[model samples]
Target: MIEALAGPQAGGVDDLTASDLLALARDRKAAEDRAAADLLVVAARWADLHPPESIHDAAAFAVPGCEHEEPIAGQGAPLVAEFCLAELGAVLGVSTTAAKKLVGHALELRHRLPRLWGQVQAGRVPAWRARSVAEVTIHTSPTLTVEAAAFVDAQVAAVAGRVGPAQLDRLVAETIKRFHLADVDPTQDPEDGYLHVDPRHATIHSDDVHYAGTMRLEAELDIADALDLDRALAHGAETLKALGSDASLGVRRSAALGDLARTQTALDLHTQGATGIRDADGLPAAREVVLHAHFDATLDGLTTVFGPTGRMEEGQRLVLLDQLRSWCGDSRTRVTIKPVIDLNADLSTPAYEVPDRIREQVILRDRTCVFPWCTRPARGCDIDHVDEYDHHADAEGRPQPGPTRTSNLAALCRFHHRLKTHTAWRYQMTEPGTFEWTSPHGHHYRRDRHGTTAVDQAEPPCPPDIPRPRRP
Candidate 1:
């Protein structure tokens, strides 16, 4: 069946029987598992080649404070050179962050979870399944001891590494408890056991807004608070119904939350007015939201038969114009319409510090980090000078090599910014909103408004200082 599906003369996929198709799919999946296993082997070898001892002298590339040891790895995992991740990521067409995780998982499995790793090598378990187990063990709270990780490996190997996420989590928890891996506090609350971890959190899923201009909210509040909020929502929903709102109960309840926010803003404003408190502008404080909505010029001038779709810069989601109008029309919401700046025009500052106008231009231009495969929003990122800014250019009376300008600035998340600053990775703004990046391994990639693309595959120059591991 493998020969029929994957060997020479395998082009007749349309003529294949249903059973043949199923067999082909299974064969392809098996091939993928083998490839994944091979990737792990390569990642492990890469880690071995760039061990801590190899890059000890290269202090600039080493992760700060982890010169002798890699802090990202598990207890029993091998230490890898901190700067090695970017080159590997470039070669493998993945993000440096992803490559680091891959190396961490490989080391965790090969050393900390030997049985599972062996099973992966023997093809009895898929590499992904084993890696999943390694991920859990490596990141357990308080950190897993060598013995605890070994216990997890034994349990997983017994099941041929066919553990689901929930089952794997439970296994890690059990192993931690069995080995007493977590630190125990003698004076802590006995009812909470040795673990004093608090799981309560209220999270607003702002990054995952939907196309309908809605966001998901989750919370784990105290029982009394939860009940009180529920009662308030119910009361607000009833009030809306009384005010002739024909929306469904669920929709009204959702709207009630917004009402609650507006109500709180109003109460605060009322108190400020009663107290005769005002800002420099002589106005009471109000809830304000800045929303950037982009509309195409050719789209009927922001009106259509239904309504033009707009892109919200905050969440990078498509939102209806109607929804935006509804939000702006809220009684307590203050909307400030700033004058539109021409994105094509370049803005510059004489000093090294970037002006707010230039920063906003950079954010609006690049929507996210300019690094390859980095999705961190530009608004939260640092506006990095594509060319290194010279602090003493004016003092020295020399030409400013790197001026603070819109064309020279690009947004980079903190980690990638550090990586660009310290590592061999280098990038330049080839054009406005377009950056060309060259990794340590001589691989070139381009990132622009559209996304990242591999631009060059030049032969990597050897770093004479870094030693290569001997192959067996």
Candidate 2:
């Protein structure tokens, strides 16, 4: 079955019978399981090679007070060196944060959850399924002990790792109760007198996935608070209707939330005015939102009719011009249009410090970190000079080796910035908003506004009669 799906003479997938298709799927799944198991082994070995003892000399470059080993697994697991995650992420085409989680799961499985690990090795359980269990155990609130993790491994292995998230949660909760792993003391704490775990939260998931100019919101609130919010939303929706809004109840409620926020800001401003409280700019503190939108030049006249799309940098989502207009049309909303910064034109400074204008341009040009597969927003990143700036050049009266200019600057998250500065990773800006990176292992990748691409290292062979260019 595997042979039929490989190489030049492989049969077309459309020609396969239904049974053959099923067989092919099974084969692919089995291969994936094997690959996942191999990845875990490799991750464990990588952790072993870059232990805390090995990174002592590199402590100068590490974040202060973060040079210690991180115990990512349960008891008896080896502590992994913190600095080794970034290179692994680059090699795996993932972010450093993801690579760290992978290493944590690998160590948790190998050292603490032996039963599930054995099942994974024997191909009886898929690596992802086992890793899911490991993730829960390793990240338990109080941190699961070795015995508790072993108990989870045995339970999961008995079912061949076919556990659902809810089931896994139940299992973990059971283990926590049976093993007395709760972090809070019931007798000592008045709020947790009944030993009940507090699980209240309100989460606004604005990053990552957004669809149709909307973001998902989730909350687990107390019954009274939930009822109160519902009543407020209902009242706000009614108010919008009274104000001649013809939208549906759902849409009106959503708009009502926005109005509520604006109203609160207004109230705060009024209070600040009464109390003589002002911001650094000598004005009452007000709510402000910075939105970056890119629109096509051709759509300037057709915006009303065609409702052209705009890229909202805040959430990195496409917003229709109509939606943008609706946001700005609110009576309480004030729209301020700032002068546009030309991304193509280079802006420079004489000193090493990056001016606010140059920094804003860099952020706008590169919406995220320039590192391959890094999604850290550029606004929060550090502006790094592609070429090291010579601070002493002016004092010594020599030409500037590196200028503080837009062309020479790129935003990098702290981790990748540190990696580029301290490790063997190197990158150069080929053009505005485009970066070419070469990893320590000689792997090359290109990152631009369009996204990341692996650059082939092999040079095209010259014709038999043609001469190859010689290096200087």
Candidate 3:
């Protein structure tokens, strides 16, 4: 294989034999797998930088500007992992779910299975095979875990690249048995265990012109419980067939299952003033998402960002609003009408405090920290004043306060908040929806509700480095 990798650049491929082609394909895949391993390691390392600062338990203090550096390892690790998942999804053009799986691989590779990580890095093991082994081995660790590693390493050294994913899994399972962890204890009481239903996989299969979404579910249940669910679905399917539904058997069965599931829980839904307002767990439940529709009839322009996804098509926004309004009375859903923003919304009285409603509007508009590339959800941020508040000098030489309104308010996560407060990152709101920030080097940037789109448009989060922005 090494010879095949060298053979391509060392000679011409035009004269290669069939065996040579096979070797080249295998070698190329090995190289690519190693590159993937390298990328995962780097991402894991980058996530380590902003170690989560623990706000609870025993506390330690860091000076205002350096709070990010003093957190213990694993402090704030979840947030960093979340950030990695979001940005990695964007970069890979994959969904957040897939990105999270990638992060799982990254963290496990870097921390739990360094020896296997090194094997992948050296191109001695296929990436999928290594990951399969890691997943099976992850929880089998104790002081006994070190022995498991050496045993697995010896097996791999004997037959490394020849193993497939299934073979690797079997090897790991067999090795784990030496430590008595290959199978569950049959003597344990079944009633003590809890059932779980999980979405095991959701995959997208597509060509340039067509696509399909496929999902598989994983569930654990007792034999009697499984038989009861099967009987219920069978009865529902028979009833649907008797009703003369035209769907195929498979489609009819699926519909029957959905109907049965909905019927089982549909009684819990309530109107705004309904007597019962609890979920299955008996907790109060109310719809919290507010859909915003921004339309200007005079200009014939309209748009709305929907669903917490922060992704909305401006062209269809008004149409979606109309459809939603039409469905309000016809469906079980409850809808409310509320104004999310105000034009002359200056709050001059409190001078620095933002009311809850206005803060909510700002958060919805921003969706995240106004700083570039920072995906910290705005709900947890400090609503910073774009223009710092201070006592104003009036025409009569009397003191006046600055206005605290939506125009001057923007969300900044804790780290960026301190950076802005203590550093030379000067900002001003030149217009209602735009923030103009100037670096110490006199570079200029514009941050609107949308994002960075002009000169000195901020660098990636954490660095606060000034990047020369380009105009669109």
Candidate 4:
């Protein structure tokens, strides 16, 4: 076979047949690949158990052994790709995200059809097909057993041919729900060993600046479940008052305790007003001031940011707000200075839609989707003006086109953001309804009235140093 398919580059066969040599090489490579993939699969399972920080640290250690100090030059995507393409997993392995899918399927199957797992491992059915049955069974009925597993598998296979392991697993779970029955309750008296607690929390923001402070209230135990909620609230209020100091009550507590206090405070206010209010401050006046700040800052900040107007300044304000919230505890009393980006509408340019009439007209022209492959109606798109009506790019590439116009805007959903930014897919609207796309391999694919056409051949092989598509 090797001799028959040998190219001019192939050397003349020696004593051994060329086919034998080729076969040997193929087997060796396959074995190596499988070994590598297996190791990666095991590694992925181990990594799931450990912290990502530890995995990162191990990656840092491996870097010293490489010719270059970095395995993937500190890049995340490439590193992930490398791991995925490891010998065993390159053809059969999955990404971390994909692996998580398997884990999720396993958990679903376990919860729905405990007996079906053994059926799957025994090869009676594939993993995904089994999962699907499990999903159907659980949804239809509840208790699953080995007897029901066979029926579930056959029913799922008939509906959906040979499902992937993950899908099969889900099907099995669903099927179990549909056919399995729960066990009957025992005739003997049942013991109640578990405790149920429902906690509530509330923060009182003093309306008056002088008296306002952040006072958290919480109930320690569930009064409804215990039939003593009022007692619990009273006890919590007393504890809070006792804990409060003149300057401020300093409650050095764990996050759990803080949460409990806040919840109890809410219950106190709801059941019996003012029962859970805690003033950590030594003076009630300071507590009032804190409460005032909280109300003014939280409520005022929300109004100032959202109530104002259109999308023009909303994005800018939101960005600044995000940064402010991160750095400052609250937006009260803190002064914020933001460098202005040009958002003024330009009247002269064709792309500029001052009154948004031009915008609607543009949208009408492109009636459907802006993306080359997408045909979704344009009604939901954000009218991004094309011309630099709002943004003025400086010489340093600061100001540029704002997202409006027939030519500049392509209707995109939130999911397509990264698809446009990172993927090989590229699109351009040449005319009102016409579009073009260039694939990652440089294939110019165009769709028109006649049909789709591939205008080019395969792209040249990329160098090792040059990154390739993460996946086909």
lDDT by residue for model 3 over 76-185, one digit each (tens)? 12344233343344344444445556656655554545666677777777777666655544433322255665566567656663565555655665565565644445
Model 4 over residues 221-270: C-alpha lDDT tens digits?
A: 34474456444544545575666623222332322243343344344345
Off-target runs (Cα >4 Å) in candidate 2 are 7-11, 56-71, 183-197, 207-211, 264-287, 297-306, 457-472
- Which is superior by TM-score, 1 or 2? 2
Give the TM-score comparing model 2 with the true structure, all chains together.
0.84
lDDT of 1: 0.79
* lDDT, candidates in the order shown: 0.79, 0.78, 0.54, 0.39
For candidate 1, give the lDDT of residue 452.
86
Query: Which residue runs of candidate 4 sit more than 4 Å off their true CA positions?
Result: 1-151, 154-174, 178-355, 383-392, 395-404, 447-458, 461-472
Evaluated at residue 347, the lDDT of candidate 2 is 95
Q: Residue-wise lDDT of candidate 2 within 348-390, one digit each (tens)?
A: 9999999999999999899999998888889899999999898
Q: List the residue pairs that clash in candidate 1.
A: none
What TM-score against the true fold does each predicted structure earn?
0.81, 0.84, 0.51, 0.30
Give the local distance difference test score of model 3: 0.54
Q: Which ten residues in a row have the lowest lDDT in candidate 1?
A: 190-199
Per-structure clash totals for the candidates: 0, 0, 2, 87
TM-score, cand. 3 vs. native? 0.51
Which runs of model 3 end up more than 4 angstroms from their true locations?
Answer: 1-31, 40-112, 126-331, 339-353, 369-403, 411-472
